[model samples]
Target: MKRLHLICLLLAVCCQEITAQYRVAVIGSSTAGGTGAWPLDSAWVRRFNYHYKHQLGIVDSTYTLAVGGYPVYKGMPGSYVPPPDRDGPDHNNNVTKANAVLASLPVPANAIVFVNYPSNKYEQYSIAEIMFCLQTIYDSVLKAGHRCYIITTQPRTGGPFDDPAVKRKLAVIKDSTIQRFGVANTINFYDGLYNPADSSILAKYNSGDGIHYNNAGHRELFERVLAKNVFATPLPVKLTKFIGNYSNASIALQWTAECTDPNTSFTLQRSTDGRNFENITVLKAKGLRSSLYEFTDRQPSPGKNFYRLRISETASLVMSNVILVKNPQEGLQVKGLYPNPVNQPDLEAELLSAQTYSGIVTVLNTAGMSFYRKETNFEKGLNKLIVPVQFLPHGQFILCIRYGDGNSILRTFSK
Candidate 1:
């Protein structure tokens, strides 16, 4: 692969060699390359590389391979430009040059790979094309036992890429990729751009032309992006318990202050079955440094309910943690199991019910083996049912009951 641009990957001192210790190669064009007067360590990659290991429990080395004059998908879709000096692939190709470098770079299989797709400036490559290029890169570095991560490019400076006509191209590409792959391997990096019309952030970040991130912009890119890759390392986050309850037609949404994307904010959501959720509202965070964020949903429907806080950033990425609000209409709360250690025929469930509903009671052992189950209707009052002991021999179990739209109530018991 050859390119019209000559992009040298910026490197930093290798941190403690991880399992395979291969360098996590960040591949992209000039925006990703980080621009400055030359030889100053102010680029985003360097900023991320400079101070992150100490913050995270572990660390990995970084190598940036972003060039200045290339479009997101390389050559625009219809028109092709030959390499400026034969340094990379012709200007029209999407990732030919980057792929060649990864295949030839001196890195181990276990290293981390972050490929920032070229900005869709020229409409050269389709989302499908980018996905193909990504898979190729993944296979190339997997031998070193490394993992790959991708940042759906940020909102661009100003160009055909940022036009309203194609504004959604980046987002569509990201969502399709995420649905096909999953959070474990393929991640959705965009946090969803708030105001599509403004490209100031993009302008600040881009290099020579206002297309890519300059050194300062690179710093924002990595911190806003690469560092948060779920595969990189779990960010040690402190989330406050959402302290509130559900009342009548109003379901109160509440959450303690939480960390947010430097470039984005949060939108609260509520779910009855966790599987299906609706966005409540979008809350702007107080800059990036302040922690302890909170938000409340003013409206909640009737029934056994749930509330969750979602974090959105960039243009397409959104993540929700595991915090649930248990306000079920025909709700059942398994407060405490009478005798924890026991040799009894059936366990007891003390349920406080507000409404009557039909539900299935299932008892599972520690290994998730369902030992006992039954479908019974509960009256709008307190009900105590004994679980048949003959179901299992001797052991501890996590008992759960599901009813009304699959909302589950949980409690633990030992025998």
Candidate 2:
């Protein structure tokens, strides 16, 4: 009977090793700090904690080293120095402190760090500088034997973001992020939340301000991370023949893998750009041998689409090679012009573009007198432009958009 009890105890220890849970640490600005999220629990980080503890049966061991309004520079290592007119690192919320805290944890080896400083440094610094700061943080995490995931920039409006040149820079930063960090180590925080017509937060997700996401937006972000299955147990698995194609307004992804463990799972992830990826679906292991699998993305983004697979077993995790598919571009069109009666301080013009280019927007009266005019760049897909109408008299006016490609559009409204 003593031998039987000893055998049971050893078996329990083995099982625990096979299904070990990891600790999560977050370092970021307002969004990760839970601003704009009502009751705070609805914030993405809190929601992730709840899911980790309640659904995954893991201990509530998540820690957030984030503070509101912090930029990437502010979260840098304590040794980092700032450029002229910029503030130095805040040691309290800096990455070095975060690393120190993680090192003191019971299981530092089983830890993952998320770096999310969306759009804070973009306005004051160059893309190269921003990437350098991010690289420093990423290296620190890696040097400590921990995995790191960087969240891409989310959409914002007003202030500097309203300027066409600044908006163009934001696009470059988003693409540069994926180039610096591989797709497997980045998350698409901007994907479904931005209004394609104009790069602002979608109305349903906006928390009354041009920046920050509301509860619905936070929920969407949490779901994105949940779909990532980052907490899954890592396993050694071989995946091959990964490919995808677009047809009939859908993208079909197919792949085969050598599955050894019955506890193995496969997660399909998709991305609009080749950089940040989000989870699409999760599949359980079918057999103990090589098996074929396929999934169709019915609502693929227009133009290039990227797909990859994350296979997880009881003791290992692997990511498949990325594949791309191309879809026809949606042509340019005016989606909407709101506040026609001009009761608000700003009139919004929503547009869908087939490609990216600069355009001139003019607000004119019935007698062809120009009231306001500005030139802005438009990205492919949906975009929203804010036109200030407060200074204009309460009269009929025309909104004319002249494209750089020698094309033009016109809409009429009254204040």
Best by lDDT: 2
RMSD of 1: 17.5
Query: What value of lDDT does candidate 2 attain over all alpha carbons?
Result: 0.81
* TM-score per candidate: 0.45, 0.60
TM-score, candidate number 2? 0.60
CA lDDT of each candidate? 0.54, 0.81
Instruction: Provide the clash count, candidate 2.
Output: 12
RMSD vs true structure, all candidates: 17.5, 10.5
Cα error of candidate 2 at position 358, Å: 10
